[model samples]
Target: MNLRWGVAGLGRGASFVEWLSAIDGCEVVAVCDVSEAALQRFDGLQTYSDYSEFLEKSHLDVVAVITPGPEHATQSLAAMEAGCHVLSETPCVYSIEEAQAIVDVARRTGLKFMLAEDYIWMGWCQNLKKIVDAGKLGDIIFAEAEYTHDCRGGMLVDADGKHYPASAWGSREDLTPTWRAADLPPLFYCSHTLGPLLYLMQDRCTTAIGLNTGAKVAPEVCPVDMESGLLQTAGGRAIRLTNGFCIAHPFSLFTGLYGSRGSIRMVNLGGLQVKAWFEDDPDGGWQDLAMEYEEREDGHHWVTVMLEEFIAAIRADTDPPVDVYRSMEYTLPGICAHVSAEQGGKVVEVPDLRKS
Candidate 1:
């Protein structure tokens, strides 16, 4: 069945138009953004500055909600209410309450709701999943993941909502801090670190405890420079997550999985690099693994693969891989972690929204 699509928030959502237009049986019919300059970039497609008007007039069967993190839940609800299936960018929801609401709306509407989480679909992550499933990783007991992207330069935004380095605020009088810069606890952005690990383990976090470096860097613009979360999964496994977007470091995604018989380390230092060790390795040393997979031909492997899967789920009228429940599994623990950090490392329970 051919699907008509509408994309809200052009900053990141613009990519969806190109992707969906290339996918078979999908048409990007409308684009929406508050920025007229952004809307102008898509010359032929229908465009709207107002979200409600876009939903009402777009004649869409699907909506990709790619706005800022704070708008994800409400935009998803609105899209589902308008009879459009939703594919939302992460972190899907900020709080347990928001997660529960998304689940309720999705259930009531019987619409496909997918969290557009790409990390799990990366080649190395997929490879790790295969190793674990094959028992090569053998009874995974502990894991560590870190997303240490230095975003200090983009902490503050100008009058037009364009981001500039926080260091540039002194040279400009009208600069204001972004919400993530001023109020977002680093742990709240943990989906990138948690989602793939949860997917690989096929588990959900039950409790989380965390701590943060209390605005040690860029104190006036950002609340915390780094935060760490220790999560206990339902399967009696432990996962450690470190998230820091404001520190001085090169952008990186790193994950280490420890198991009874073997271990895996995957890091994205500009490019994917994978290393592993097994009990009977020929030399008993870390073996470097290739990161390329057959799916790389599909263009932007992770994003393309994830989008195609979401579309396939919709076409089959089935739950998406990262459906509402799984999205919460990948997202809510981070919120719990943030609460834990705020409470001086007190353990916080992550609500299973499926049971709510």
Candidate 2:
């Protein structure tokens, strides 16, 4: 069954459009964005600047919420209410309340709600998961993941290799006093770094102690605020997650899982170089494991894997791998970590969404 998709929010939504264009079982039937220029970029696809109008006329099977961080919950709830499934971008909602509300709407509608936590689906991360599930890593003790980038100059890049102006979102006069205040918290964008760790460990974070430096070092270059913090999971394991768009240069994006018997490290995006080290090899002894996967020119095509999984769930009447509940499991910690940072770095207990 081809999943007819109505894509909302054009910036990152454009990536989803490119991905769906390649998938056999998915079609981008309608596109909606606040920008007319964004709508003009796609040829021959039904487009709308107003999402409500798009929903009323598109007759879509799924609505992909690719809007800004603050708009996810409202848009996702609207999509579910319109008798369509929803696939939202990460940091699924700005707060736990919003996440719970979206989850509730999905439950009430009996529709699939998925968070596009793609890092968990990367080829390299999948290989690491296979090894850990095979008991090669033994019991996991501690893990660390970093999504550090020196995008302080700017987050987006244009076709000419020039950085897009940071003022596209909002003007300097409209920003908050500090960088952190200018945009969403750094922990709010933690899923890219946290998803692989949670999936590999098969564990949820029980509590988190977040430490944030409230300084706005480069207010002019990158307006978005930033923060860094440490996360401790339930099984006495710990993982440090850092999200700062204000850093100098694009550095490392990595995750390391240390188990009783050995440990695995996935470096760069798509698990490019996954390294495994056994306890016996203490001195300069680590084997480089081939990722063993082909790279797609358009890496976004991996979203097809996620779409196929959702379609399979619809056919078999089973929940997808990144279902609403699972997405919340990955998201709640980041929410709590932000709350922890706000409370002067207090350790906050992540709420158990599994309970009513």
* Tens-digit lDDT track of model 1 for 156-255: 9877878898788678888888877986788888888899899999999999999989887788788889999999999999999999988999899899
lDDT of 2: 0.76
Candidate 2 structure quality by residue, lDDT tens digits, 1-356: 67899999887789889887777777899999877878999878999989899999999998989987778888988888899988888778887788778778877888998889886766667777778898878899888877766554454344432344454435433322222234567788888888878888877888887877664665544444566667777777888887776655465677788889898887775336778987766574789888743343336445677777877886676887888888887887877888888888898887667674
For model 1, the superposed segments whose C-alpha errors exceed 4 Å read 292-300
Question: How close is every model to the real structure, measured as TM-score?
Answer: 0.96, 0.87
Best by TM-score: 1
Candidate 1: 10-residue stretch with minimal lDDT = 292-301
**What TM-score quantifies how close candidate 1 is to the native fold?**
0.96
